[model samples]
Target: MAEAAWGNGELARAVNRTGTETGQRLKYDASAVSHWLSGTSPAAKALPVVLETLARRLKRPITAFEAGFREMPTPVDKSTDTVSGLIDLGSLDMDPSRRGILTAGLYSVALTIPGWPDVVGRFERLRTDPHLRIGMAEVRAVAAMTERISTLVDQFGGRMARPMAASFLVNTIVPYLRANADEDARKAMLSAAADHCYLTGYMAADERHDSLAQRYYLKALELAGHAGDHLMYCTTLRGMSVQAVNLGHGSTALRFAEAASSASPQAGPRMRAFLTGQQAHALAQTGDKAGALLHLRTAEVAMDQAESKAKAGGRYDPSSLAYHVAQVNYELGDREGAIRAIQHSEKVRPMVYRGTRVRHRSMLAEWQIEAGRLEEAVQNWHLALDDYLAIQSGRADDRFRSMLSATRPHRRNPHVRELLERARPMAGGRGSARTAQGAMT
Candidate 1:
């Protein structure tokens, strides 16, 4: 506070304002700051808000320990049993009353990622139900259920799908993990569970529950390694890169992307494209222009040669490639190219991906507005609203909020006025585009 030149009241006001922006109602003032300075701790729910306020003021990452709170969880603690951890996490996520605690977690950029070698085949023996046995049939069932949930999430958004995922994970997958099985079937079940865990983490990230998503991602990595499922392991790492990049953590995103690529020595063209596309985006954000373009071209070529599949990472198709292109162009300050690529993405994108449709359309409008094409931007925003109203998504809410703020200056335009009128009733929801913008620095 001294270094940032903030008085007690100023810091308290900033915390309260930030908490409100993020959907919390905080009432801190000079007295609260005075108490904190006298060794009183903030509530668990408010600690993140306070830390975020300080980090914003100081322009650096500040951890709980650095702010006089207890240290955050160590990255990839080896002693924790993955199955038990999944049960605890899923239980909390599934409960509406406890879910707010999970969502309050801030995304940490300072955490170290576990290496591939360190995770592979690392498993501690967990309790098993001797009478409850599972076979390949159960493994197949888990995989099938995960696929169905994934489809629902892509179409309708994670706001609805994630609760179902948590329920299934806690009620079904955890027992399967603890059930007895043959060696081969056991490994297959572990692999299947890892994929399901990865999907849940993806949903959490989609909902912008960053720290909870990280926990799920870490568990997925552990499960994948225990099963020796290299594909899921690499895929999970790449997914982490996506989460980090989306949150505007450039160097952290690049590091995860490179780690994912290095871990997958024998990846096929589709997987190659999947990993390289993210690498290109991260590189562009990190100002590695030569590396960004080089990897992007590699992704394009790999995507061309890629076989179409209904499996996990194999879903990175031409539409996904175009979205990556748009991101790269946007990061490199090519707004026109970014708009064009996003338009192309919308055209090629399959109808099942309604969630992406809302996101991409909203993003296209934002870019168009930035490029000073108000009419075109309004048209896209209207299209975005057509789907956005039906979905439950944090990302969509962020985009919706952005739409409101971005069009405030153009309220005199009849179309903008009407859009604002339509969106006025929904303005009080959470999720901020500023978090993404803040990460750019």
Candidate 2:
């Protein structure tokens, strides 16, 4: 309270506000704050609200231990059933009023990842809706909805699409999970749900909500295990690796990537490419230049084999492979090589991936500026802006902010000045891209 410079009443009101926004009917007041200050712990449910309130004021993540509450046994405590946990998480994510708190979660580098055996066949007893029944049709519906969400993320970014995904997860998918079904249908639904959760987690990471992404990713693992979907289990692990790598947690990312590869005994060519590409990126981030290059070559070979088979629909492709190459080059201090690889990524990237275009192109511009190619950088920035205008993504917003910061020193240049002037209104009118929210199975 003293660090945050908040009075007892103010702290209580802030906690109360966060609680209410997240669907809790909290009635904390100054008296309650006084009691807490006198060594009385808040209720279990209210602890998050209190911590989030303090984090907001302090402009950093506030862990339970730091806030004088007992820390969870693990970074992410898994005390509840997976299905129920998903429902709660989805409910909070869908509520517009709760976005800030969810987005503010700290990425847990020490996240305890469940191994294949740990999660396999370990389902909590779900409360089935005796009156409800689901079948393959409902399973297909869920898969289709997940695919649609993926497309939306590819095009417009995660911000606009994630709330809908969360609402669907809570209002539709959970009920289906609880609905009576044949074994085949039940397994199929579980796989579909796992895919949806993975995609939702990816979106959460895209928006920079690392902790929320890990939660969804972990649930995806649990669901995949229950479904006996080894492929999806591995895919979710790779997704977690992607989240960790993007957030600069190199060892954690490599752990997830390696775990994904090690668990998938039946992985095909495309799967190999997907897994290895991420491994290369993680290895690069961890400063394993030789190992990273070796993995990168292996990924390229696998991608070639997969494309020869005319496979489609998998997330990893030539464009994504090039991205890994770019990431590897950049990590190893090969800025020029990174620039070339990323440009290839942009060239071969499909038109439907408008959000990625914005991010990658903007990144390309940043590299160009660093290499003293201001003219080329300015042009790419303009192209990035062309796509940026249509998307609602936190990552894209990050790129926009980066552009402003990077170009400020060169503002005297006419091209840079013109770009800044063009971006002025966008910076002013942009949505709350302040943060963070994903499917594949």
Candidate 3:
């Protein structure tokens, strides 16, 4: 099974997607995976790989763990009991509270069965347990930690943390839900899976890898459907809409934004506002300044209303507010408005999406430079550069290169050259891992 063993790590690495936070991908020290080759068995959830790996090695479609042959024997009916049902169930609850009941950290990892005894026993002896479950909080923490890591990537450019982030998403978030969660928890797990998908997609987008972003967004949409979180689903749709816009698919962008607005239940003032603004940006790209402006005003008023209300859980984040608006204004040739929007965006300062916002900020600075605000653009780029530097250097793509690739007359401008030059260091800056490692030297 050495060949199979080699393939296991390769497959694990393939799924270890970095542009997203990836903490949970189990890193077994030397020869950990090699254990399976001998007469070793993996407990419950690890079967997905154990089976697939064995199948690959044996040169056949490997089924149940028991069917896995010599060493690893999957328990009877264990796969059915693991997490598939929970993910299905969690997706059904409309009320957030009733929707997905979270398992405490103890049972989250331990309670693989339907009874209380086994779960409690595992919790009581958690320290001695060979396999520790990923607690619900740990799962939930993925959502939070991804946000933080994204910011670091955005602020600095993709960094070493990018791979680390990818690991968490795959190992902790993806597998935990895949392993645990009941029919009820399944629904919630789908939402969580969607979150993982979105983070990966968003980070990929930041790295300028649109194809991967598209794949992740599509997966996020599918997972969101399972979670039954309409808002979240639509939010991801909006994300796809943004990608569409990035790809010069203004019509597609408009479709997604409209869908976001339409799918939204009440079209809450804030959510609607953001969606409308997105549509407006699409319209602006199509030279529909009037239509875009109309949507923009509608969006602003909605934001005003959202501001007046006090609510929580599952709303379109306000982090991209300024960035989106600035794009609209820049396209419309409203220098002051675009500048103001950029200023406003800094105020929202999303704690979650900070991973790769530099490119957005860089765009803002480019506009400022265009508006003859050389000093302001330079000033704006400093912060933008800092953000760019924060991302993993390997992942920091040359977005400006694409701009130059386009036939836009602006690519020839001196300001654009300056901006691209300024972006290089940020884009190439070492990640935290490299920096720390280098510091020790």
Residue range 62-119, candidate 2, lDDT tens digits: 7788887664533766567888888889999999898666765545565678888988
**TM-score of every model?**
0.85, 0.82, 0.57
lDDT of each: 0.85, 0.86, 0.55
Off by over 4 Å in 3: 1-159, 311-319, 347-357, 393-441
Model 1 score (lDDT): 0.85
- Looking at candidate 2, what is the lDDT of residue 168? 96
Q: For each predicted model, how many residue pairs clash, with residues at least 3 apart or on different chains? A: 0, 5, 54
Which candidate number would show the highest TM-score if scored against the true structure? 1
Compose the digit string of candidate 1's lDDT tens values, residues 1-441. 888899999999999987874578999999999999888889978888898788867756777778776546436465657887898899999999999878777676655667778877776556979889999999999999999999989888887799999999999999988888888998998899899999999998888788888989988998999999989999999999999898888888998899989999899898899999999999999999999999999999888777444453447889999999999999999999999999999998888898889989999999999999999999998898788756777888778778877887888899888877666544543344334333222
**Who is ahead in lDDT, 1 or 3?**
1
Local error of candidate 1 at residue 257 (angstroms):
0.9
lDDT tens digits, residue span 265-331, model 3: 5767777876887888899987898999898788877777777777733334454556667878878
Residue pairs with backbone atoms closer than 3 Å in model 1 (clashes): none
